[model samples]
Target chain A: MKIVITASGEGLDADMDSRFGRAKNFIIFDTETKEVSALDNSVNLNAAQGAGIQAASNAAETGAEVLISGHCGPKAFRVLKEAGIRVYNTEAKTVRQALDLFLQDKLVESSGSDVEGHW
Target chain B: MTIAFASGKGGTGKTTFSVAFALSADDNVTFLDCDVEEPDSHFFIKPEITGNEKITVPVPVVDSGKCTGCGRCAKVCRFNAITMLGKKPLIFHELCHSCGGCSIACPEKAVSEIQIGTGVISSGIRDHISFYQGLLDIGNTKSPPLIKAVKKKGDGASLVIIDSPPGTSCPMVTALKGADYTVLVTEPAPFALNDLKIAVETVRILGIPFGVVINKSDHPFPQTEEYCRKEAIPVLLKVPEKRAAAEGYSSGESIIKIFPGLGDEIKKAISTIKKEAVR
Candidate 1:
């Protein structure tokens, strides 16, 4: 299964980006293959508005089955849900730790957006 | 000629001067209160609202059956008003600028436009003077479109006076666009002078001939006059600070009626604007 994590930097060791829309990078890790890839997201960091919508489309197009982030806004959550991507939040400090928690069945799926749009 | 009265600072007496000028014009006069956020010229003109017309702008809707889920519409929308998720498109109406890019970008012709009311225009006549006012709906951030609707009523009138909203932003620019002359009304104060400088730069950039009207001229702010002189900006009128002007405004009366001799001053200012604007 491919898991997409919003990260502050490259690789699984990077910190988990709290902002879903303005994250620095999206790290995709394949659990079966143990392969990792990074998608640069600097274009949306300075967006005047609607960064979440653009970021959601970018994440959905990646064909990732699951999304892991510290926080998600309503617009991004809606896009993820419609794309059949279940969202999960973890209190883990790093992307690698969050992935580990998922494997251990410790991370719970988000039922709805935790914050309003523009948050 | 179309004369727009604009100011960068709010409550700088843009409406007061615009209303007085409209009343002073002997030719067919149309008063457009373009400050949709807080239109107040109607209080002074006291026009009998003949009727109201709803103003609508086009927003895109999708045909579910025809949609190909190509995501082209979302890509074309710059406002983030539309986005696609697994072939489903979500529309956020408030963020939409009604640019119609989505409908034009749809390859399958699945997108169509629907009219949505943003505001209303009230039209009436106070004796021989025509009056038009735009009242925007609460929570609606769109005012330019509403201002356009109100400004259209002045098309055939001999003289059109637009009372623009405060600030040198989109609302003020929209109201002042295409005017033959713009009267930048300001008071003798620091904040008003600061905003007036910006307002002057905006009109200069737009290439609209403009002059300054110093309201409350009795105040001891010499820097404003000095700045205007250094910039070579024409000082058309200086209305002395009068207690009656404030008292009359509170009672919804124009200074032209409350203060004697002010009517002729406005008339002279109009002639000067006509000379400066060159038709």
Candidate 2:
């Protein structure tokens, strides 16, 4: 299974980003192959509006089965759930630790968005 | 002729002076409170609303039966108001700018537009003044559409006084877009002067004939006056601050009642604006 972790930098050692919509980068991890690839999310940072919706679409397009971020917004959560992707809300200090927690089943799947979408 | 009153700084007497101008005018003047978010001029005008209607914006609605799951509609939306998941697009109307891009991008003609009410525009009369105002629904983010509707209500009036919202952004531009003249209300204070410079830049960019109205001018802040003089902008009116006027404003009385002498000053300001707008 592929898992996506929102990160502040491009790699396993980068800090886990607190925000999911305007996150700086995404670190995709392939559990079976132990492969790591970075997806830059800088384009959505200054988006005039609906950054969460665009970010959700981007995360789903990466073919990740699960997304791990500190917080998820309502609109983004709906999109991910519709795309058959599950989000795990966490405050893990770094991407490496988040992956470990996910493997150990220490992260809880978010039933709904923890934050409201900004208009 | 249409004249808009705007102050980049909030609470600098934009509504006060504009309402005063409309009341002092000898002819039947239309008053539009384009500050849909707050719409405070209605408190001053006390208009007897004769007509009111909801204003709406068009947002995309996808036809699930006709959609091809191609995600073209989602791709074409600049505002990301539409997002496709599992071959279906979810429309977020709040984020929609009503550009109709998704409808245009649909290949199978699955996308259609629907109207969602964002606010209400009202029109009526207060004596010789024809009054109009837009009241944005609480928690609704779309205001430009409502402001436009309010402005439309005052169309064809010989004299129109538009009280625009503060800040030089979309709302302000919508109000001042085609005005014959703009009165940039300001005060001789630090924060007011800072915003006044930006407001001046906005009007200059729009190429609208504009003058400054310095409220609370008795203050010793000579910087505002000096800046206007150096820029060659006309100081249309200098209304000294008065406690009596403030008391009258709180009680919802016409400003002319508090300061009877102000009627002549408003008349003079109108003449100067007419002369400048003509050129």
Chain A vs. true chain A, TM-score per model, equals: 0.96, 0.96
Tens digit per residue, CA lDDT, model 2, B1-279: 999999999999999999999998888999999999999898888999999888888888888899898989888888788887767788888788899888888889999988988998888898999898999999887688888888887778889999999999999988888888999999999999999999999998898999999999999999999999999989999988899989989988767788877988898889888889943
lDDT of 1 by residue, B1-279 (tens): 899999999988999999998888867788899999989999999999999999998889999999988889988988888877767887777778888999999999999999999999999999767999999988788799999888898887778999999999989999999899999999999999999999999999889999999999889999999999999999988988888889999999998987788889888888889889846
Provide TM-scores for the models: 0.83, 0.95
Residue pairs with colliding backbones in model 1 are none
RMSD of 2: 1.7
Where model 1 places Cα greater than 4 Å from the true spot, the runs are: A1-38, A63-77, A84-119, B218-220, B240-244
Docking class of 1: acceptable
Candidate 2 stretches greater than 4 Å from native: none
| DockQ (Cα-based) for each candidate | 0.47, 0.73
Worst 10 residues of 2 chain B by lDDT: B84-93
